[model samples]
Target chain A: MSKTILIVGGGLAGTIVANGICRQMGAELRSGALNITMLGTSETHMYQPGLLYIPFGRMREAELFRDQRKVLDKRVNFFVDPAKAIDVEKNQVTTEAGRTFKYDYMVLATGSRIMPQTIPGMKEGGHWFYDLDGARKLRTALNEFKGGKIVINVNAPHKCPVAPLEVAFMLHDYLKAKGLWDKAELTYTYPIGRLHALEPVAHWAKPEFEKLGIKYETFFNTESVDPQAKTIKSMEGSELPYDLLITIPPHQGAQVIDDSGLGKGGWVPTNTKTLHREGSANVFVVGDTTNIPISKAGSTAHFEADVTIDNLVSLCQENTFAREYDGKVFCFVETGLGSGTYVWFNYTTPPNPGPPSQMIHWFKLAYNRLYWLSARGLL
Target chain B: MAERQKIDARGAFCPGPLMELIAALKLASIGDEVDVWSSDKGSASDIPAWCAKVGHSVVEASEHDGYWSVVVRKAK
Candidate 1:
């Protein structure tokens, strides 16, 4: 009998694993083997990078999206319902719509969620571009805007490590195009000392901000936002008033993960190299849900997918897990005035910081096309 | 009726050469050609494909020293 594989989350990491499994299964199925099931809540798959473009008027929300269900290959059974609980001991998953599926091996690809309106007054005043709904909300707010202090703050550990910077630079471009450049005071605030966790990137990014005349406020860990008064206060008592508050809220893994006792707080604790869930040999994690100390971005997801699939194949064949995932994160930071930068880090407990390059920007711009082609199984 | 701008994008990766070419095209004259030198294995085929799709003209492309120089004329 063929072993069953149940995958949760049809996002970047999940999709890659499913497609790879199908390719492997194709060869196996010819010899007769392999059963796979994939579950997701929505049919639409979003191009997350485009959310930064939406606020800047560079790309439309409609153009930056695709049907997720159609995107997946037909070999794996796709379900358009969210996975609510995973009975790890029994190897079954309960969906939000009240259906259960069993499997021999399970993979968690459930991505992270932004806590925006969860903060008081955010729904009433603060704006964001984290999700499709958040992007839409921010768009409506931008359309009616004049000009004042524009504050973009990071809540920290969010998906797409470079996103906060991308949004900030795009906003700079948007305002300059509208002739509101001088009228606007753009401030980018982060809890960390640098623009990004990677010190070299922070070193490079700080100078660019100086050239752009945009203010960079570091070490201001945001406690909360008093949107009614249009003021954002940090834990240090420093406050910045904004006409438009573009905030990136705190992110955590899926709630279902916590409910299943598979996660603590919001993240699934796992071996960074093995991706094996703590104490469970048959379960693995890929993407933002892992408690790996790296940027939870799509590239990382793609990289992790490669590792997870390899390990899964090894276990199935009763082979020792040989490949260890080195936390490799790549990001494209957009700098306004028609330029961007690329940054990569090879995490080894103490990560080795790679130098920033103009090539990184071109690489990122090119990634859009590469990703499209890659998703189609063309590359 | 002018000399085309030259872009030495040799030894660059997939989209690097392409993006440099696109960025240069924004500054070039209507009839001026922009030459891109790329050593990447993918760029030799990609440049011509991009020109065909976007209505640009490919003047000349040749292999040189672990790289290829693909010249593009801005048609529109």
Candidate 2:
């Protein structure tokens, strides 16, 4: 009998998995040995990393969005609906539109979202560059910013950990080009004591931060923001004043995962190596939705997709899953002036940071275009 | 000498130069060669990898002052 595979959240993770399966099991899929369906919230897939360049006026907003249908494989069926709940025992999923799907196997790729309101006074007082709207608003605020104190505060475990640092580096160059560096007091305040979660990255970045004259304040866990007063109070009661506040807010998993009792603390719990949800044999999870310590990044999702698909294919043929993910994560950090650094790491090895160079910057630019091709299994 | 067209993609970011090369290839006749000049560093390997994937032939790829130029021919 043919097995029905239902994939939730047709973003990068889900789309890549679907394409990978289609490429590997074309004959089996064509012979009615397997069927695939992908459910997503919308047809537009945003190239999120491009958001980093928006505030600098380097990339246009329109260039970041693509029709998800065009990027997905034709062999897979696509739908636009929010997943409402998962009935693990019954092997079924319920959508917000009163539709339910029965699956022999399921893949969870619903990514996380930023919750700015979680912080007191943050929704009203702070600006961020994580989203398109926020980037647009920050662009206007940055253009009007004539000098004074500029703060890039990170509130929680935000997606793409390197972004805040990249913004700081870019802002440094941007201000210098505008002749406002002399008057601007630039500061980067993070909740953690280290500049980066990875020690090697911190070591690599320390000198660059000093060279740019950016004040690095560690253990500045923001407790509240006094927007009208233009100040932020840390949990330990220290206060820092700012002329403009760009903050990365806290993140949470999809509400449906929590509603289904498949997650705790707004994150789905899964075996870090197996990519399977705890206590579920037929269901698997990947991407930012999982409670993993690695960076919640698209590169993580891309790597996870490979292992998940391999295991799923194995389960179909051998009645067991053998593939294991090693927590490999890769990222390119843009360091302004058309140059950037690359970091590669996994569970066993510490991140090896490469020096900032223009060549790596071009690779990042190439990866953005290659991502679309990758979605369709063309690259 | 065979007719060779030059595409000036210098200063353009990655895939920008490659996309321009692809578009130019679409308009060129079979056996016509197109030379692409790009300042983006990935163009050196990316262009050749793309050519290999799609069955095009790379004539010559050379480094110049702060840029790289790749020559490709429509093979099929």
Candidate 3:
């Protein structure tokens, strides 16, 4: 009998793991050695980073969503249900509809959630562009919005760290193209200093904002939003009003990870070099849901899959887990007007350094097409 | 006498060579010329295409042992 491997979540990282396992285990399955099952709640998949470009009228809503079943192979059994519980001790996962599954190996790719309801009046007043639904709502809001104070409020630890800055720059470009630059005031409010995570990279963005006349609010760790008052209060007790508020929602791990009795501090803690979930030898995690000290982006997930697949295959074969995946991430940050900034980092050593260049913009565009092709099993 | 700038983009990727040339052109005078060496397979075609679109003068474009050298003159 073939040993069963179960994977949960179907986001960017989850799909990558699903595809990786399918590609590797297909070889074994053809020879009668393995069985795999991939589980995810949604049959449709969404390209998340495209959310940043949605508000600027760069990408359409229909372009971001695709049927998940069209991408994966027909060999692996697919489950279109949410994983509500996990029994790591028993090597089983339970779905929301009371379906129970048992596996010899389980991979957690259960990405993340954006918590806007957590903030006061945020769900009602502030518009977020973190997910497909959120992007659609923000697109509608942006389409109707006339010249006024447009605020991009960033909550802590959001996915795709550069998205807020991209939104800001794109909005600046959009308004300028509309001849509404003088009529609209674009403001960016972030909890962190500068625009990006890297200091040197951040230095390049400040001038872009200044040149575009976009206002910036540093150290503005938002506390709550008062929809009726049209105000957002900072953790430091400052308040700002906006004509339209676009926010990147606060993120948290999937409910199953938090309830699995495995995650620490609401996120799966893992070794930096090994994506093995802490306190569990048979379980692995990839993507934003892990509490890794790196930017939670798609590139990080792609690199993590390289490690997780190696470790999972080794463990499955009873071989020694010998590979150490140094955390490496690369991404392109859009700077409006067909311009972009590329940032890459390798966190193998102390004070991980980020190398930046403009070529990354084209790289990002090309990679987007590559991702689509890969997901469709065409590459 | 004429001033010339040499940019070695042999190890870089697609838009990298183009961005390098653009950044260099910003610091050079109108008549100053830049020679870019790129190993990216697409650079040979992309550099010339970019020069055409942006109205820059292409002095010379040739393939070397393993890299391509494209000379661009700032037209504006």
Candidate 4:
């Protein structure tokens, strides 16, 4: 009998794992020795890195979306439904639509969700560039701005650790292009003590931030935002006034993981090296859903997929996972004006970012195209 | 000189130039050439790579004045 492997979440990690496994186990899949099914909430897959280009008008919204069906391989079964709960004891999952799936093995790649409402007045008062709608709104607001204090504030545990810095750098270029650089005061505030979570990246970015005249405020735990007053207060009672506010809101794992009691603090706990869920033998987790103590960026998902697929193949064959994930992460940080930097690191090595250059920027752009091919297991 | 269509994708980011070349190739007749002018450094190599994958032919790829111009012909 064929063993069923059900994957939850069809985002970058889920799709990549599905396609990777299908390609590697083609004969098994064709011979009905292995069965695969992917469950997702929607048919649309958004190329999230394109969200970074929206504020700069470098990419259009239409270019960022593709049919998820087109991206997944034909050998993998896909369902458009949200997973509701996981019964780890029974090796089964239930969906919101009352459908239940039994599996021999399961993979969770549900990613993360942004909670803007967690902060007072944030939804109405501030804008973000992480989502398509927010980016479009910010683009319009940025285009219509005359000149004043522009603040980029970040809440903790957000996705894409370098996004706030990228926004700051791009905003500087945007203002300079409009001849309003001197008229606008750019400030970036983070809950962390350093400008970046990664020390090496912070070191390289400090001088660049100085050159762009962007003020960095660290240890800024957000207390609340007074949208009417156009000011944000830190937990320490300090206040910063702003004419425009762009916020990276708090992020949490999917509610299903929490509801199923598979997660604590809204995140699934998995072995950093083994990529297996804590206390679950046949369950594996990847992407932002797992509390992996790394930047919750797409590159992290891409790298984790490699380890997960390798281990999953071993599990299907030998009833044991054989591979260990190194926690390798690669990120392309856009510094604006057709230039960017590359950050590469793993569990053992800290990030050693190279100087910003146009070539890295182009590589990042090329990645957007290659990502689709990658989703189809073609690249 | 053979008739060639020019796509000025200069200053556009990666995949943008490649997408433009693909779109132009769709409109061109077999054997007609499309030239893409891109300031993005990746275009010089990416366009050729894409052409090779999809059965198109890259005729001439050259650099000039802060940008790259790549000429591709629709093979089929």
Candidate 5:
């Protein structure tokens, strides 16, 4: 009997998992002993990290996308179908097109999405860069601005933990380059009491922010935005007025997750070490959809995908599981257009961000291009 | 004499080189040495630290040209 692996979500994690598995299980696939299939919403894959550069005009729109088919292995069966429901009890996934896929093993990589609508008035009063349309609109908003109070409001449980700070720093440099640094007042608000969830990063950013004269407000959970008044109200009873409001709105897992009764808020309960969907031996979770208390960055997804591939290969070929996933995450943070730094940590270790340098900035840019290779499991 | 294996991982980014080193070390004899050539700046510190934590020894680590060559010997 052939082993079938059904992967949901065609984003970074699913693609990587499919390609990585194919890289090792080619003989089995050719012999018809194994089948790897992926269900995705679109045929095009977007490099999400590139969204950070979009609002600032740092990257061309063409550079962020590639046809998903070209990136995946030729042996894998790829479908441009979205998963509508997941039945873990029966080990089957039903797609939006009314097709049900049964599998020996299943991978849930149905990443997260922003829920600006969850907050009152946020949909109308605020601008975001988490998606392509939002980034383009924000670009236009930045271009037309003469300069005034700019509030960068950050919400919790968003992917890419450092992006809010990265955008703030980049915006500072962007304003400076446009000769509007003095004309604009930048203020950042976070839901937490600290500048960052990571204490060390909060310490690192505080000095950098102070040096740039960027102001910040902590413990400000977003309650609503009043476009009519050009003000944002926080649940803590603080209201901030802005000429322009850029926000990192809170995120939730894909609606299919909640609809399928898999998890609340679209997040699947997953074992942190094993990457297994809680209580489902053959079901694994990866990427933003998993309810792991870690930074939901692409690197985290990539690392998790790598471990899934290893264990799946062992299970398919040897009838035994392989290594456990070390809770690992890495992220490159840009201090400005020219300088950047990175942090890497596992379950046992905390990240200590190094000093910013231009070389690291170059590496980040290079990685932006090198991401395709990484997705193919070649790097 | 301990057998030595060479890995040229200069162009790969962080974790890439380190992952390759770990894979190589797994296939190596207990007394064998693995020399990794990595251009990633983090490898300088990450390789040595990973070696120490995992009970491997860093036989030599030095910079040459644009990359650094770190040598590790499997202990167990």
Candidate 6:
């Protein structure tokens, strides 16, 4: 009997898993003993991390996308139909196109999305760079601005932990280059008491903020944005007036996870080590879809995808797991226009960021191009 | 008999070399040495740390012109 593997979501995690398992399980696939299928929402796969450079005009928009079919292994039975519901007990997934897929083993990689509309009046007032449309709008806004008070507001559970900091640093450099630095007063606001969720990163950023004379307001949870009044109010009783408002909006997992009643807020409760859905031995959860308290960065998804690939192959071939995911995450942090540093940490070790340098920045640029290879599981 | 395998992972960045070493060790026999050559500075320490956590033994580690080579013996 042949074993069927169904993967939901064709993003980073799912793509890597689909490509990787195909690479390792070639004989099984050829002999008609294994089936791998992927369901996605689109034909184009966007490199989301490249969206950061879009607002700054540092990277071309075309450089951030690839044809999804060309990137995946030819053996995968791919579909552009998005998942509507996943019934774990039935071991089945239903798609928005009114089709059903039954699997021997399933992988849920349905990633998260930004929900700026959740914040009252924010969708109308604020500018964000998390998506392509938002980034293009922000580019025009930044390019046309003369200078004034600019507020960089951050919300929790957002992907790419260092992005807010990176944009702030890059914005400062941009203003300086345009001779608008002195005219512009940049203020950063975070809901937490520090600059970042990670303690070491907060400690590192404070001095850099001070050196650059960037003012910050800690504990400023957003209450509402009054576009008419040109002011934003916080739940902590702080009101900030701004000429330009840039925000990192809050995030939520895919709607299908909630519709299926698998877990609250679209995140499935997952076994941190084994990457399995809670109470379901045959179901796996990967990347941002798992309710694992960690950065929702691309590296997190890539690492988890690799683990899932290895385990799924082992289970199909040997009725066992190959290894466990060790909670590993690696991310590169851009400090300025020309310098960067990186952090690598697991469940046990805390990340220690080194001094930013031009070499690491170059490496980041190179990696940006190599992301296609990474998605294909060749890297 | 113990055997030696070499992997040239000189340009791979953080976690890249470590992941490659793990993949190689899985295919090697017990007491086999997998020498990982890495230009990433973090790997000299990271490879050994991973070995320690996963019950593998690092026989020797040394630095060359611009890279480091760490030899590990798969214990399991």
Which residue runs does candidate 1 get wrong by more than 4 Å?
A30-32, A349-363, A376-379, B1-76
Error (Å) of candidate 5 at residue A119 is: 0.5
Q: Would you list the clashing residue pairs of candidate 2?
A: none
Report the number of the highest-lDDT candidate: 5
**Candidate lDDT values, in order:** 0.74, 0.81, 0.74, 0.81, 0.87, 0.86
In model 6, pairs of residues that clash are none
Residue A19 local lDDT, model 4: 92
Q: What DockQ does each candidate score versus the true complex, computed on alpha carbons?
A: 0.01, 0.01, 0.01, 0.01, 0.01, 0.02
Chain B TM-score of candidate 6 stands at: 0.93
Winner of 1 and 6 under TM-score: 6
In model 5, pairs of residues that clash are none
Whole-model lDDT, model 2 = 0.81
Clash totals for all candidate models? 1, 0, 0, 0, 0, 0
Task: Determine which window of 10 residues in candidate 4 chain A has minimal summed lDDT.
Answer: A190-199
TM-score of 5: 0.83
lDDT of 1 by residue, A1-379 (tens): 7788889998888888887777655765455467778998788877777777666666677776678766777887899988988998888999999999998899999988886655566556678888778888788777777888989887654677677777777777787888888888999987544576455556767887888888978755565688778998875458899889988886768889888888654578777678888788888899888866556788788888888777777666655785988777666777663677666555433233455456665676677657755454444
**Position B17, candidate 1: lDDT:** 65
Question: Which regions of candidate 3 fall more than 4 Å away from where they truly are?
Answer: A349-360, A376-379, B1-76
lDDT of 6: 0.86
Candidate 6 segments exceeding 4 Å error: B1-76
Candidate 2 lDDT over residue span A1-379, tens digit each: 9998899998788888898888888887999999999989998999888888888898888889999888887888888988898888999988989899999999999998887887789888999988889999999999999989988997565678788888998899999999999999988986544576556777777788898899888656677888999998876457899999999887777888878888743567688789888788888888888866567888889899989888888888778776799888888988885899888777666577878899988988888778787667566
C-alpha lDDT of residue B43 in model 1: 68
RMSD of each: 18.5, 19.9, 16.4, 20.3, 14.5, 14.0
Tens-digit per-residue lDDT, A274-347, candidate 3: 78887777788888877665667888888887678777777767656948767777767777746676666665
Question: Between prediction 2 and prediction 6, which has the larger TM-score?
Answer: 6
User: Interface RMSD for candidate number 2?
Assistant: 21.7
lDDT of 5 by residue, A143-175 (tens): 998889999998765888889999999999999
Q: Could you tell me the lDDT of residue B4 within candidate 6? A: 91
